[model samples]
Target: MTSGPASSPITDELLVGALELERTDRGVLPHRLPAWARAQCFGGQAEGAQLAMAEAQPAGVRLALRTAATTVELDVVRTRKLYRGVPPRPDGVYDLLIDGKLAAQATATGGDAIHIDMSTGESHVERGPAATLTFTDLPAGEKDVELWLPHNEQAELVDLRADAPVAPVPRTGRRVWLHHGSSISQGSNAASASATWPAVAAASADVDLLNLGYSGAMMLDPFVARIFRDTPADALSLEIGINIVNGDTMRTRTFTPAVHGFLDTIREGHPTTPLSVVSPLYCPIHEDTPGPGTFDVEALREGRIRFTATGDPAEAKAGRLTLTVIRDALRRIVEQRSTHDPNLFYVDGLDLYGPADHDELPLPDALHPDDESHRRIGQRFAQRAFTA
Candidate 1:
């Protein structure tokens, strides 16, 4: 949805900008998060630019911000300046206005102090959103506040105002979610991101999203995990498979254990958080295949490849890796973990992205999904996976 200034009594706008102080091209910029940094899936940094701007603003001024919910955090740095009030209490909530409209209000509280080294030195503080702050009163005097953020090569400002808050509605905690995935759940180019089974399911159910998909990167690394862990989400979903099969990240002996370990790490803090684990979508590449992945660098570089060269049914029988293997792993995980963690659930990834989607939305790269596919997948995730 388009977010900017609101229409009503408040006319003044607070202008905030951010610029990088160092020479690195990867620092955070005002209003915009670093692309590479986002790719890393690290928390705290997502909204570093926006929070930096908020910190610099004077107390009692309303602020509007535009970005993903996961980007907000509280960590002070000399490089990042605050207007007044000796840094906000870790538990304090800051009103977040996006172009005169309130997008989300957040606060971070109750955590062991961690020291962050900026241009200054080590400082102890808690980071991450502790809770969502709600404002019932508005500050008097200046109707708005502007924040300037500087990082690396760019600088920009964001304006906020208390006079005009987005039209307030009853406190219904409804939320729309955006999600992304890889071939494992894309049905290997599952129809489209918007309709990638997940999108279809989400749409049939109703949801929202901004899907960023890369077919090869669904390895349960810290990056992808951070994306889900940090984002303000009511429900989250993950389809695991394909990459492990196609790239052959591990052996069958190691695959099951790896999956278990990955889930364990995520549940570290999100104990009661709702989660859905999806097995592989349908793909003929490893219908019954198993073992290590075959490599052909020359063909890969030429951008021409096939799932496997042997096409040997014997490989399937030998227990390499297949959809069944993934499904079994997921079931085992749910059965064992569900006793203690009631919120954890499982889904068949193929339900969203499957062979049928292939015919409807052909795979452009035979591996990674195209933009259209990303949308389809995102929409589906919002619907099926996100629904409580």
Candidate 2:
């Protein structure tokens, strides 16, 4: 790498110098390699690029990131065999470090999740990798920084930077966003952790994200709200509806009280933070439907599959919950809470994944969205909810 003044942001120029396989007493120069890099005979994976700034300096270096994008750049050799099995899903854990301290971390997974048709012999690059974790407001002082990769897989390092770190833009004071949701928020099938919607929202809005999206277990629990209460946040979002509906976790009477209790617990600590209660997006299966259970016996007998009984059309309309119910519940909650705290907010889940999007971007499994859907959701959020 180009060793210059020690106090510069590690930039693309510096990365170019360190591209070769250099021998060092501490093993090899490129320690980790992604599968694609290995096939190309490039033995080292570019974990990531980082910038170190002085924490105690007079002019404290503020890193203002307009975007945290992750793209896969590779030169695949025809002779190499692409690894099989479900490609890793993105999970935001790839961290950016400054002075041995974590400045920011992004998580991503390789393979098909990023819409890469690896089955065909085509070079793929998934843009806008997700941000899993981020540490901001570094104290101005010189610090050595590095990228901490989540997995040891190999890939070449390309555009990395630190010198001339982008300065933070002036705005209202930072907002801590604490969110709780389901698999979609948990990163699902995204390429890496940073590509997830929550991560995307956090980076775009310039805020902290404490994601509590349980993959298969999003039961509206008092414990979960307790967790939210303990964490410090300036704003909070509860993406409810879908998980409860999909899991068929509770009855209408139970659902109402559970939601109320959950919010009550969160308010114990964050009584004044701007809170937004969101319902489920537009889902035909559960839009006006209710659930107790349903199953596809034909598919099951063929050893193909099974289904849940909760989504029957008539039953859903009768005793089960619908997006409308959630909307009403949220409206009531906000109305009641607004009487005491006027900062409460409500967003319809349909706003995120409405009926219009369904026509163009159908959920691959009739449940979770495809990669395209994820991108659309993130973009919509950036446009509407995140602008504030």
Give the best candidate by TM-score. Answer: 2
TM-score of 1: 0.47
Best by lDDT: 2
Candidate 1 global CA lDDT score: 0.44
Report lDDT (Cα) of residue 275, candidate 1: 78
User: How do the residues 116-142 of candidate 2 rate in per-residue lDDT, one tens digit apiece?
Assistant: 333463444333332213334444443
Error of 1 at 230 (Å): 5.2
Per-candidate Cα lDDT values, in order, are 0.44, 0.51
The weakest ten consecutive residues by lDDT in model 1 span 148-157
TM-score of each: 0.47, 0.56
Each prediction's number of clashing residue pairs: 47, 53
lDDT accuracy of residue 91 in candidate 1: 29
